[model samples]
Target: MIGVSGTLVRGGTSKCWLFDITDVHGRGASLEDVLLAAFGSQDHSQIDGVGGATSTTSKAAIISHSYESGVDIDYTFAQVGVGVNEVEWGSNCGNCGTAVGLYAVQSGLVRPRGEQTTVRMRNTNTGSRIDAVVDTPGGRFTPSGNATIPGVASPGVAVGLEFLDPVGSTTDALLPSGAAVDDFTLSEGAAHATLVDAGAPAALFDAEALGLTGAETVAEFGAALPSLLGLRHRAGVHMGLAAPGGPVSHAVPKFGVVGAPRDYTATDGTRIAAADYDISVRMASMHAPHPAIGLTSTVAVAAAATVQGSTVHAHAKARDGEIRLGTPAGVVSARLVLDGERLTGVRLNRSARVIARADIFVPRAERVPVALP
Candidate 1:
């Protein structure tokens, strides 16, 4: 039997289990094997493991104090597969980055500085850097406060997540195809897409073109899943994320449909007016509709909205400063800082909490030959 130590934390809209790098590597087992066993990846319900059995909840991270200059923490975001034995390391999660910030100080990885402890994290998966400002009043670590963000019901400690130079995390180009828009041919039909690589690689389409209102609730977005998933594959190829007729990435080029905000009811049944938000967004997580926008998606959308001919820009209302995203949960605010048309970084105000420190015992890992990222 293999014993694994983990800390579960609620970061923004997702729940992630963080494992110390030492614990993960000290076992002498492949990361795929250890994570699969710990998450019970072979079970759809994840009934036998700590996994929450959903895309947002079934995530894990390996973290350590970084030796890299100017960086304080190093982490690898692992999108552990649901009902399958696989892990995707091609992307990063800003929400998890929030959790890492808090966990760093709480775990003594970094010394608290004054009131705001800045935990500079380097995502080893995508080589993206994130500055997580954790609230530690008077140089004291604290995880609970009067702060809140959309999607999650309870309030927690505030963590400011800033993605620095986040463009081209995977493709090495802001616009992976060298153009703001690309033509795609999918089983659903033909459509124009904006394949941007900011924060995380993502493909955005105008909802009207996909026969969508962009304000559909999670349940209502069900019918459009097949077509959007098909679009993801085509966009992946166009962005050079995959070769022609090759297996596409399950994470990259995160798919989203955007439209001008219209009066609609949120998932919680709260009415939101068209004037209240700048744009509407419906992003997919793995195969399901994200209850709220992912921080990475929020970053990408804000950047895409700045492009004149991009899908998001075409549909978003004219706004200044922070961009408001009308998600199923509610409106989310994301700000893009630029220096004379050159984007510097994206900023988001999120909250996170350390749920628990746990010890998971794995009897035997399922035999699955999944590759490391």
Candidate 2:
């Protein structure tokens, strides 16, 4: 058996296996094979592995002490396919990024400074730098707090995440297609969409254009997966996020449907009044409705909302400041800083905690050849 030491962390709305770079044995295909074994890929239920069998839970974060000046740690996010043996590293997970600072301090990868510690992280996937501030009392990490975030039942330590210069993460420009609004051609008709790249690339569409109310339950969204995926692929091609006629399975340029806020009941049976939020959004993860909105997508949504003529902009009530977005799980808000038409930065709060520390074992037959560092 091959043993790897790691920690299971719940960051924001996603759970991930966090590993040190030295503990990982391989690279490229070999690395993917190891991850597949560890996460029990090619199985719908992930019954044989540590994975939770869901897109949000089947994630991995590889970290290393950064050699770059001013950066505390380097993080790489991986999306492990639940029913397939594939690991996509095309995009960074803002939820996972929220926990990197705590991981660094806990594992001694970086020393904490005073009562509050700030760790500068460089996301290897997109080469974006994020400043994560975690509360440390007497140079020790603190995991207790009353701050709460949607999708998480209990409150934990509040981690402040600032996505600095968060534009064009995956593409060449903020608007990769050079248009705030573009025509996304579908089989039945065409719809107006906005392809924005802030922390991550995303394709946003007005819910009405797609015959959606933007307040769909997870099951209801799953029922429409085929058509939604088709629209995502078409938007990917139009935004140059995917090559013409190519597969859109890399998971970059996520797809989301947006609508003006309205009174509706959430999946949790909680009433969400229209006046409580600025807009309503529904995003997809691994072809399924995301229980909660993604942190990176939140930045993309805020950026798009600030841009005039974009799909999100039409539904958004205000041009800037705190934008509260209602999702299937609950409400999430982000503070947007815009300089004219340019998005300067985005700030948000997330809670993270170390759930467990254990060794992840891979069977001898499942182990791949270890690459020399």
Candidate 3:
């Protein structure tokens, strides 16, 4: 039996259970079966496992001691959708990165000191250095504070997440195809799209092209899931981001609608009035729904909104350099540093809490092949 210690944490808009890959056994089961057991199959209640039902709560991360100097740990992400059998490992979840640093410190892997502790993590998926800062009171991570972000319902200790060299996370180039935008000819007609690979590969399209106000609620889109998923699948192929009809397991090359803020009702029935944000966004996770948005999508949304020719730019306000976006939950604020046409850096804020850490026990009866159907 292999025993592993794990921590279930909430970071930004997502929650994840973190484990060390070295401690876990059985990579034998197909990703689908593994995810089903990990997240509790057919159970949105997650009565038999740790999954929180919503995509935000259906994530997991594997962390290991880093061999590289100046980096504390290596992070790998796993997206386990509610009913899906597979776990998507194609991209990194920045929200999950927040918990990793704290987990490292709490587990005695790294020493935490002063009020602020900075931990550097190497994202194995993207080969990016993510810097995380936590406020420690009395030499431990403390969540009792007035710190707050717009999206989360309650305020907790604030953790600042900075993605270093995010300009080419998924692909070697910010504009992977060497063009600011790609001209894709759908069955209907040809439409211009932007392909940005920073943090994650993302395909950008105007809201109007899909008959969306860019201000629609989550329900409105859910009602059109068939078409929406089809659009995403087609766009994935169009961008040359994925193979023609290949598995849509890769969450990169995310599809989203960008439009200037207009008065709209949020998923929570709150009014996301035009005055609240400059742009509106709805991002998918593993081709499933997300209660809120993820960090990578937030970066893509901000980058597209700031660019001059994208559809989002039309409704964007001429403000300071940073771009603020409104989502189903609330506003997600981020920054994009532009070095002429090249993207230099991306930054954002997130929250994380350490739930628990203890050895995960694997019974001897399971010592045989961890079988899956």
lDDT of 1 by residue, 1-373 (tens): 6898999999899899999988889586798888987888889998878999999999999998888999999999999988998999888988888988889989999899998989999999899999999899878998788788877789988899999998877878889899988887656667888999999999998788788888998888867887578778888898898998999878887888888889989888889999999999999988788899899999999999888889889888877768999999999998888888877899999999999999989756544567999
Per-candidate Cα lDDT values, in order, are 0.88, 0.84, 0.71
Model 3 misplaced stretches (Cα beyond 4 Å): 1-3, 25-36, 41-46, 186-192, 338-341, 358-373
- Model 1 lowest lDDT segment of ten: 361-370
**Evaluation by lDDT, superior candidate among 2 and 3:** 2
Candidate 2 global TM-score: 0.94
lDDT of predicted model 2: 0.84
Q: Give the number of the best model, judged by TM-score.
A: 1
Model 2 agreement with the true structure over 34-139: per-residue lDDT tens digits: 7788888868888878899998999999999889999989999999888887899988898899877778778887788987789899999999889888878787
- Sort by TM-score, best first: 1, 2, 3
* Runs of candidate 2 exceeding 4 Å displacement: 26-29, 187-189, 365-373
Query: CA shift at 109, candidate 1, in angstroms?
Result: 0.8
Displacement of the residue 209 alpha carbon in candidate 2, Å:
1.2
lDDT accuracy of residue 108 in candidate 1 = 95
> Deviation in angstroms for 10 in model 2?
0.5
